[model samples]
Target: MSLLLLAPALLLVGVVFLWPLLRYAWLSGHAASVLTGLVPLANGGANWQRLLSDGRFWQDTLQTLRFAGVSLSLELLLGLALALLLHQPLRQRGAVRAAVLLPWALPTTVMALGWRWLLNDPYGPLNRLIQGLGGSPYGFLSTPATTWLFTVLADVWKSTPFVALLLLAGLQTIPPELEEALLLEGAGPLQRLWRLTLPLLAPYLLLAALFRLAQALGVFDLIQVLTGGGPASSTESLGLYAYLNGMRFLDFGYSATVMLGMFLLVLLLTSGLLLLRRGWQGTLR
Candidate 1:
């Protein structure tokens, strides 16, 4: 009876998600003409071969990793700080926490547009502020380094709030008595954090990191709207590259290969993290 009840949802997932992915992976090995319906030919492994040999593909992969790494690191740090701040009792804590969600709640496209305006090379608030501070107007999206920096900043801005919220929830689950007990034992704030709080927060932190990493790895809209993988392909990410290949160039075969590659990589990475977390939890037990 329970299995019958769960059948609908399972059928929906199989039809809507698994079907398309399997179809795409199967088609990715075919020739472009076959994909476009111009001819029927199975060129096994050609798409994957081309993708593997493409320097641009490797470059985009590196850029994606770099962007994810820097953004997630900063977001984790800032989120921890914000979570700690909100974990304490304060009169406006509720209001502040709600406000923190604004960035995360806003649509990614809108946020990207707002950031684009803010980082505009000419007549933008950011550049104006820089000039006012006796610095030259800087190119944010048009330069390689600046593009990466702004992309990281945008991601961190939108994502850190979510991280803070997760960590705060974790904080609430922790019994207050633990901190008080540590305090009574002459533990300083730093010592308490190291010896008590962090240890308890480990699972939550790992889970949060896993979620953030996946989100960061798949980032597309913000970078697309902000830089469009421009300035000599400096800001090209795996997502954007896949998009360009699939939609822009109509190279569905190659795009599918890229998508499949990304899917496998993310799956492996996430699995590894979860395994590590499980091991840690077992050790703690």
Candidate 2:
């Protein structure tokens, strides 16, 4: 009866997500018809072949992982700090929450544009401030390292609040009496955090990390607008590269393959991380 009742949702998933996913998977292994713009019936390993041999693809893959890893790490640390701070009893807490959420609530393109304006080489307030401090005007987007640094910073600013909100929700679930008992025993704030709070909040932290990791993997707009994948295609993520291929170069076959590979990699990594989280939770018990 449960399965029967869930039939509608299953149908919807098939039509909206699974069907298209399967169709794209099929297309990924086949060549696109040049004349008709349809997928050919014959299988062509050309797309997959290119991916295996392409150095640029490997570079983008490494950069994507690096960008996502750094940004997610920063977001988790900052978000945890914010959650801890806000969990305390304080006046004006509501106002503080609102201010913190403002950046997260803004559209991503808007945030990216704001960062771009701030990082402008010649006339940006940041550069002007540096010039006033007797420092040379820096090329924020002119190098791989600096361009990626800003990309990670921009992502962390926009995403940290989300992580905090999730963690704060988790923090709220803890009993206040436990902290009181710990205080009576002369446990310091740091001690209580390590022994009592961290064990409890680990699940939430992992959950937030997983969410951010997924978003960071497919990051496109911020880096795209900031660097246009240049100073040498150094900041080009898999999503941007696939987009350029499919739309700009009109290589639908290769683009589809890239998308499929990306999806599979994400799925595998997500599953592996979740399993690790489950094992860690078991150890905690």
Candidate 3:
């Protein structure tokens, strides 16, 4: 009966999510480019072989992984702090919490474009401030080292609130009596946080990490609008590379293969995180 109740949702999910993935998988095994008249023909692992030796694909993979790791780390850390702060009692706390979420609520393109203008060479406020301090205006968007770092920062700023909200909900579910008991036992703030709060909050942290990791790994709009994968493709994500292969180069088969590879990479990393979480729980036991 329970399975029957979920049948519609399961079917919907299959069609919406599973269908596209299956289509991509099928397309990946064929040749479907302008040279092939955009018709998919079986290529017998040719695309996969090419992917193995594709230097640019590997470079984009590294960049994407780095971006996801750094940004997700920052987001998780800052989000936990913000969640703890919001979990406290304060005047106008609802308003404050809502304000904190504004960044996450904004459309991604809007936020990315805003960052692009803010980091524009010579005219952005940051550069203006640098000039006032007697430094030459810097090309933030045109610099390789700094550009990727800023993209991570921009991603962190926008996504942290979402992680915070998830953690705050987790905090809410924590029984107050547990904390009271700890306090009566002479537990300090840090002690309670480390011993009680974090352990209980582990599931939420895992949830937030998994969600943010998927988003960060598939980051496209922000990098596209902000950097356009410029400065020698320093900040190019796998999603953007796939987009370029499909749209710019008109190679649908290779593009599909890239997308499938990205899906596998995400699956691998998230699975590893889940395994770690399970091991952690075992140790806690």
Best by TM-score: 3
Runs in model 3 lying further than 4 Å from the true structure = 1-3
lDDT of 3 by residue, 1-285 (tens): 999999999999999999999999999999999999999999989999999999999999999999999999999999999999999998999999999999999999999999998887899998989999999999888888878999998999999999999999999999999999999999999999999999999999999999999999999999999999988999999999999999999999999999999999999999999999989899899
Q: Report clashes for each candidate as comma-separated counts.
A: 0, 0, 0
The window of 10 residues in a row where model 2 has the poorest summed lDDT is: 33-42
Error of 1 at 46 (Å): 0.6
Winner of 1 and 3 under TM-score:
3
Model 3 TM-score?
Answer: 0.97
Q: Give me the candidate number with maximum lDDT.
A: 3
Tell me the tens digit of each residue's lDDT in model 2 across 125-241. 899999999999888878776688888989999999999999999999989999899999999999999998988999899899889888998888887887888878989999899
Worst 10 residues of 3 by lDDT: 138-147
Better of 1 and 3 by lDDT: 3
lDDT of 1 by residue, 1-285 (tens): 999999999999999989989988886887664356734357898888998899998898889889988998898889988999999898898898899889999999999999999999977999999999999998888877668888899889999999999999998898999899989999999999888888888877887899988987887898899889888999988999989887887777788889887777678778988999879889888
| lDDT at residue 99 of model 2 (Cα atoms) | 91
TM-score, every prediction: 0.94, 0.95, 0.97
Candidate 2 lDDT:
0.87
Write the candidate numbers in order of decreasing lDDT. 3, 2, 1
